[model samples]
Target: MKKSISKVLLAAVTSAVMLSSCSKTPDESRYIPKTAGVVVDLNAKQLTTKLVTNGITMDKLFEATQSKDTSNEVMKAWKDAENSGIDMQSHFFASFVFQGQPAEHKSYISLTASLKDADKFEAYLKKNIANFSLKTQNDFKYIWEEKQHAVIGWNKSAVIYISAVDPSNLEKYNPGGSSSPDYGDPSEPMIDSATAVTDSAMAIPAALTTAEDDAQIKTWVAEVDHLFHLKKDETAGSIEPFAKLLKEDADAGIFVNPEAIYNSGQFTMIPANVKKLMEGSFYTGTVNFENGKIVFNGHSYMGKELAAIYKKYGKKEIDMDMLNKYPSQNITGFISYAFDFRMIGDIVKATGMDGMVNLMMGKSGLSMDDVLNAFEGQLTYVASDFAITKKESPYFPGEFTEKPDAKWIFSLKVGNKDAFNKIMTSPMLKEVFTREGDHYTVVNPMAAATMPAMSINEKFVTLGSDSALLQEYLGGKGHIKLPDGIEGKIKGSMLGGYVDLEKVTAVIPEDKMDEDEKPVAKKAKELLKDVTFVSKADGGDVQHGEAVLTFKNKDQNSLVQLINLGTEAAKVMQARKAKEKAYEDSLFAAPVDTTVVAPQ
Candidate 1:
């Protein structure tokens, strides 16, 4: 009867152990420290779903990339990941943490993930790694790879991997001192191992030489411990904006702390005052892969002082009338911006650097105010009618070559005409350009021939590549009608840009391209459609921006299209290489003419 009781007790203990190992872990974001300089989060379930929906699998990817070796370590590891006992559907987080002082500074990288079965994970590691061992310390178990300067620690439900460099291996932080090592002359005799050791002993302090190898390992283990034991308030989830960004159901998200990054010891050259200004500033961004396009949305939050400056100046709207006046109706691309120039002067004065700027400008008979006041802070650059055509070479007359040509115009709204005239007629610029009626003309004949025509007036200053186009614009005889998709976005944005990829690809001159290049160009033209971006200030301290890269296929996911394009391009490259090799081999295999010839 006693023997039967012993057997039952053992079985109960085994069951408890199994149950503990299978418990679910907390959210991955909880392991990221609030002060982490940079954090990248990946929603594995969303990514996997998208891949599966697109008919993309690991085996397919390997085949596409032409990886036929199944016995390789990478392939073996990938196969093991299928049932490695780690939760594949949960989120994964990678974070960068900067800690310690300048003298003993250390940067730590940590990757946190959930576990499905701890015992199975351990077994998986043992099977993959040679001579692997697990060491238990306090409340968790860990593995230290001394050569890799990394440590992996795990609890019952989660795993954390931390890697850091030993501070002793880094050079001592000596202010205003040269730290370059003395390698001596390369021609000098090599030292024996005994001599080298003796010299090293003399050069390095005893304390450094005697430091334990496991000191960095201990620190990394401590970091792992801290991650697993973080309080609710200490995690990145506590940051309101970052938390909201993650909750937006994005495939991936990123959070950056500029204050923490600039204040780190690695950036010691940044002034303390500048670092202070960066305090409380952070940025959050999200990425989504959608049908026909990839979209990126981001928000930037400024600190109190910067926010005050921005609010004081307020936001400026782009001058649609000025942009509409662009002479080209077939524009391939354009970028427009609206911002108050005076805000730059205000910021310089606030930072106490205006005096130095004015002193430098005083030599040119101009003040910082004169330069900043010349523009009303609205500008547009447009490029249209891109073409590749054959033209006679200037250096070698009658020799024709293919060259790319485009019509481009750049214009800026005039703020104070008097300030503009003062800058234009300054001693520095007066020698190169001469005032001609209502505009300025290049004085040098060579420059006049190559440079674009410049026209200036009280309302606007414009430069154009074609003389007729410039005259048409100045006469108000031309008006631009933007595409419907781009017009809506550009009209509502303070900063806007558009690129017509179809127009660009149409002018590539595919008939003149090499056989290998033709396929890639054709694929690119089929895959790309257009690109557009919009950015605006949200009235307070927050700013928002978004960009979209659209593809030709409206029904397929952009990620899948990109993968297919990459695979096809790789195949073309492989074929090209094989063709070149065959030609080389043919030359070597040809029979040589062995007939003897008499000298003449």
Candidate 2:
């Protein structure tokens, strides 16, 4: 029982997070309060939005480090960074390298970022990078683009020189060696006789929030809202369906102010860490939220175009006022709205037998996320049932599940082959399924992904809580299967009857126990004897891991002194041997016999 429950709980969480064959809250009201001031800065290794004076916030700082702004003084000094040669749109990965030594008075730090999309993603990147340059004047050029690059060299402190022009004097003053005119691979060879910084100066980003910062973030939020429009409507083809709620005698007061989210005055820019939380940083749209509506207005550059395409395929505009009324005598208007209206009613309406079927699905007491997720999981199911209409149900999986242990399994499916394949191939869908977080979202077909949609769709999104809506539609066998007093316990989360935990736990028979039966459990107990279940919820397995970095650091000054004293100290002796081996390898035919080993 416990094992089954554990699997059920975990699968439930995964299924809920992923799309399912369920209805989710169509409203965005409840989610807004959660976003307030929650900025997770991923680069800094911090998971928070609280502004600190000393630290930098990537949400605002990346643009500064990514772009060339003369107004900033520290940035102006770092000329190469101004034109780091990497395109911002295409730059998504950051490579970190630690160079040189601290005691030798030569230290360096560099971060490289990239933005490559789809197939051969990295090779496409390598071909686009630039040659590395090291000048005798303590200058370096690491630009990956055509021509222009940067070089750094240091004597007292590090000095970096950047050149768009070959004749620029920045690389003229030699520091380490004779000059090399070659512009070859940056990593191929450190152009012999080329300059080295003999010194170091590290670069860091500027400040985090400024006063002007607040204004810009607000503008960003507003722009996200405008593109995703919301239609204030509930058209369940049968006015008779909402009979109880719409009747003159019944207590059907409209829930006009469904919910007002984002009114908390607690809001902050989306966190830099949001990317790390996602399975992949790449996403389909720019997401934000308004009062009652959570808007995914699409990417600023791609939102309008993508949404227009969806609209073109999914809907045609119609008379908004004629949406919800009982038995409207106008047959022409009704049919027009049915075909011409946005495909929204296709998702959540009470019109016709199908809408009633869906309405029953929504009000079945399953949480909205779970319902929507089932659909996402079985897109094949929905598409198969609704789209192209395949002939049969698997009723059973055909691949791996039937075998005792197998390599494959069939998941749910929707028959919309095109949409089905698109989802299957999407990195975003993989992310939505495997990566955990508040990542999966659904939107109204007609409603724009904006704040206004919040007010309009609030009722639909928050339907899980509206017992009244469910109650109004309940009539036939599909209405609900509640026992005598089950309706009273529905909110209490009783599955079907008046059972409680006390009565449930009483039925645990010793013979039915699996925990003591599985040997793996015995071995797990031994392994977990010292290891902690670091993050257990509901008495479940814990997740934990550790990191380790080990390196050998030797003081070369001791070797230098011994050499000057004409004495072979153990350290100097070792250094000489190491240096000899390095030289031998530098001129080697093959040093496969020499292996790099970790210290014991």
Candidate 3:
């Protein structure tokens, strides 16, 4: 079974590679079934252009990685197909579609690619058909079993390979599912009819209501018949929402419908909590590349219930000026988000989770609002600096300098000092912390030695690994210093962070890395040495976020650096793997002593 599946996989890979090398662009919508749960569209020409611009062309990469000795027939055939007069400029489209309902659900994966020369492509498949476990029916060739089913077909300039699955059969492959014999009688009722009904009125529990096995089996059979007998131009039904997204020109993009999954009833046993969350939201995301970053923007449209909840709580703008207090120039990165604590209480009150929260608060002799109001709801996290410190080794003989530890500081503005003070001076904190002036340190034997000590000032509290760093912050010397153009990035953002890649990468000591890892790390360090990232997000009618990577040398932008870095990293990894393989071969090839020694 494994070997058969492997052959199918090999054929699929070869088909994709061969089709990718073709130049003809066929109508993508023809092969796309309307019932598709996800649709992926690839603009091969655009992607190839981008990759070539960055010195990481896919064709060259594949040629470079091709094995020298093609001892395997399947591989040799594939190489021939690739080398054959095929155009390598075309778009590719793939779709995942469901054909049946729950209990006996089935799915199909369809791939469509354009062919430069239909005659040559067909000949290639015919020559290599035996390499896969395939059977012929008319013009189509198919491979089907308990685990997987696949179909391959072509028409003129269009080529398609589809892999389908009967999800009901997956139970046979599930290792964790119960294999025990079923002692329950098939005729037994799911619920006692006498107790379930009274005077012709029937009451059914949610768990007891289920489609009978026989009914599900019939549905599965019907679906299978329909699938096998599908017309060449039959419309499976299009998910228009996702199809519309494809209209936007992009190098590549994907669309998924969670609501469709929820409605399928195929996996009806979704958790209650997740069901509520899923039913309360609709989401879609799009991808596009900018000058430096691969842009991803998404929207979560709340259902009536969730939307009402958001409308009740409202939103607030965070003051970026507050960010000036933290030592920005000294810190590698910092993330700060502002919220109104009362809004959280309001949300909990509006939502149904307040009952449990109130119960827990009552047990602690506190009100829910009081607990929520302890902090001002403005939170800042500072990753100031890092150090590679040596420690005793447990696995090896000598101590080795491990990875760097980021010096982090967390500051929270206090709204109610009285409430916070009471909690801070509680018996629990007294047991864990020892006070000196306005600061406290962990004196507990169980606490990690690296745990930060904390200090409290009027209307503010700060915690840091180093007391001096916290002092610097209190003295206003630890505030983040925004770069010249950074103000523009953070202007309307509710939450933002700045990452100094140069400083962060400088802390990564390549000299301390293992011999095999040093080269890879060195390449990464060199590539990212001048890159810095600033990301910001805003909350309103439509939530928006943007992250931009800035380079010291304008010529070496994020996209170019990323491509070059990936190329170099791949080379390093390939070299390391080759070296490891050679070592293994040498060990295995060592001559064995065949001489029998005389007994003493």
Using lDDT, give the best candidate's number.
1
User: Residue 444 of candidate 1: its Cα lDDT?
Assistant: 94
**For residue 119, what is the lDDT in candidate 3?**
66
Worst window of 10 by summed lDDT in candidate 3: 190-199
Q: Candidate 2: where is the Cα deviation over 4 Å? A: 1-306, 312-600
174: Cα error in model 2, Å: 28
Q: For residues 60-113, could you state the per-residue lDDT of candidate 3 as single tens digits? A: 444334323312433443346454323344556666665556444456566666
- Candidate 1: list runs displaced more than 4 Å: 1-26, 70-75, 101-105, 165-212, 511-517, 573-600
TM-score of each: 0.82, 0.16, 0.67
Clashes, model 1: 0
lDDT of 1 at 176: 24
TM-score of 1: 0.82
Answer with 1 or 3, whichever has the higher lDDT: 1
lDDT for model 3, please: 0.52
